[model samples]
Target: MTEAAARRAPTRAPEQDPGARGGVRRSSVRGQVLDALRAALVDGDLAPGEVYSAPALGERFGVSATPVREAMQQLALEGAVEVVPNRGFRVARRGARELGELAEVRALIEVPVMLRLARSVPAGRWEALRPLAEATVAAAAAGDRARYADADRAFHRALLGLSGNGQLVQVADDLHRRSQWPLVTGPVHARRADLVADAAEHTALLDALVVGDLGVVQSLVREHFAGS
Candidate 1:
């Protein structure tokens, strides 16, 4: 197995062995494969528009093709990949325009909510999200795109969750995930310094919100989405 695949492999407890619980073991393997595939997509390990067979991925992960196929089907549903008849799955080809649209939609939904939160939510509430913001910075500094993506989403989710609207959070999260997909024609991985700068924006936004600076909050939010 590849080192990346090895790192992503799930460790089973003795009682959860395949022999003792075949179905549970399969499900666990499938879930791990799904997560690994998503990480691969975010990290640009899976090239856009390229078809990849389950057996090929299975060999790389040192697992049977069944779990890989199941995970690819889930990715299909997520629009991360598409079925290719009898061949395999092709990584979805996302372009700059699609990414820009996703960012626009996110800003439409989140900007107003954040502005409102800045006015109503206490400074302590904004302060509480500092750890999550810092996590993104750490991940960016480590040059780990997958980890940075996860941290970025967590920070946004937590910030949006403050609205107390489950549906809004779900919608915003979907948009956020799509925005993270790499563009097919440009540099897949961002420069480490760019990642660090982007991560710093979270902290800057929080600082603006804490001080009840609506103008600064609005400007930061719009500029952030524009950069996305």
Candidate 2:
């Protein structure tokens, strides 16, 4: 290799590809480890306040300790997990104020970006959004708290897809994934009516998108996140 090539950082040195969806490319052992660990973290497979055993997790993912250690290090950097001294990685704890701030920052970054990506928001995008929003509404109506939360998460993910910036979508996902901590802190059992109302508000946001109403859409986003 030339001097310049030698000086370059070996990003893929050990066969890890953290590439985005489409080229999704979750092919290598390291990539599999990272993706599995990330899924477990984000999907509440490892619940809030649940301590993760590095070796146990490695066993479940069918890998050895080394890659699990590396993945845990990366997750810690991403704020998905916390590194406790001599205790390995633990799920990060968060409170209501922190969750609300996360949603606020996501709105601040994403609303404008979504407005810009409005042209690509496709005429049929609302068709895709409707079912997810309805699923949230139905879950809320049925008083299924966990299912409601999952549906709520799906609604946000669909909204993130509106931005069309693969990287930016992950920023919003990171913020929301951290939200589950506080999401269950309150009386979600008593909040079904409120959640249903939130789903209806999403309908309005969908309508705003349809009409290309940037101001109203941004306002709706702020209001929706403010209650978090």
Question: Clash totals for all models, in order?
Answer: 0, 0
Angstrom error at residue 101, model 1: 0.9
The TM-score of predicted model 1 comes to 0.90
Position 7, candidate 2: lDDT:
27
Native RMSD of candidate 1 (Å) = 2.8
List ranges where model 1 is wrong by over 4 Å. Answer: 1-6, 9-22, 183-190
User: What digit string (tens of lDDT, one per residue) describes model 1 on residues 148-207?
Assistant: 888999999999999999999998988888778763334535567678888989999988
- Model 2: CA > 4 A from native: 1-78, 85-88, 117-122, 142-146, 211-215
lDDT of 2 by residue, 1-228 (tens): 222222221233333355654433333555657756655543346666767777877666655666777788888887778887776788887776677778778778776776666656765776668888788778778755456666777887788777667787777777765564433434645576777788787778888877777788778877887766
TM-score of each: 0.90, 0.60
Worst 10 residues of 1 by lDDT: 9-18
Q: Which is the leading candidate under TM-score?
A: 1
Clashing pairs in 1: none
